[model samples]
Target: MLVDVRNFHITGKEFERRLDEVQITVNKNSVPNDTEKPFVTSGIRVGTPSATSRGFKEPEMAKIARWMGEAARDFDGSAAQVKAEVNALCEAFPIYQ
Candidate 1:
């Protein structure tokens, strides 16, 4: 998933504020990082293919989505618990031998 910050018409300060809302392990990059464009981007990119390939199913995905949504709305730096949960989940289904 990709969130285009430009569409929000938010100032830099607002961007900063919004940044604190998420604690998900997503990659945040500027415009150039997105597609080699000259414009500066305030976008967020998230991927779950790897997890899916590792055998993460719908229930796991739903949990992850909830975490992402909560993090993106009003994160309070309590993602450690969520991280632990994710780690446990991943450990339950290893991708490598």
Candidate 2:
């Protein structure tokens, strides 16, 4: 999913920072803008290959997507809850046992 941060009133870098705070890894990407520049980084690319490899199914992936959206929409207001959920998910499916 491509999360555009323009509507969120923040830069892609800022969005990535918020995701990182919640242990969600994503990459900021350049997107078309109405400015003179051909492209401006106002979005982040979210992928679930790693999670899939870690045994995350559709339901888990959906939850992760929801968390990403929630964090993007209200990081300050939802950080603790999102972080706790992320930690719980990670604990349930640890990368290394």
Candidate 3:
């Protein structure tokens, strides 16, 4: 929820010029047994510019987001799985050395 879009533009209005920027998604989730706390306990950012550059469509974004949610839910079990998944993806579609 806390992000700085300064790199996208010079001013607020300028940044608003690109609607997609506001639509980015991240991967994280939580539930307090459906408790009284904020139900919006998770967050995701899929629309970042880097995602587009890496050829991630919305579907891919959603898939990764889901994996992240699962990982967040089961920090120990899912974390290792997500890490392996990411490593595989990176090896297949390397963007950096």
Lowest-sum lDDT 10-residue window in model 2: 31-40
The global C-alpha lDDT for each of the candidates, from Candidate 1 onward, is: 0.58, 0.82, 0.43
Q: Following a full C-alpha superposition, what root-mean-square deviation does model 2 have from the true structure?
A: 2.5
Task: Tell me the tens digit of each residue's lDDT in model 2 across 55-76.
Answer: 9998999899899889978888
The residue pairs in collision within model 2 are none
lDDT of 3 by residue, 1-97 (tens): 3223233222223222222222323432232232222333322223456666677677766766666445434444655666666667546555664
**Model 3: colliding residue pairs:** 24-46, 24-47, 25-44, 25-45, 25-46, 25-47, 26-44, 26-45
Which is superior by lDDT, 1 or 2? 2
* Residue lDDT tens for model 1, 42-93: 6655577887788888898888777655444444564566566667877788
Residue 66 displacement in candidate 1 (angstroms): 0.7
TM-score for each predicted model, relative to the true structure: 0.56, 0.83, 0.47
Per model, state how many residue pairs clash. Answer: 3, 0, 8
Candidate 2 Cα errors over 4 Å, as ranges: 34-40
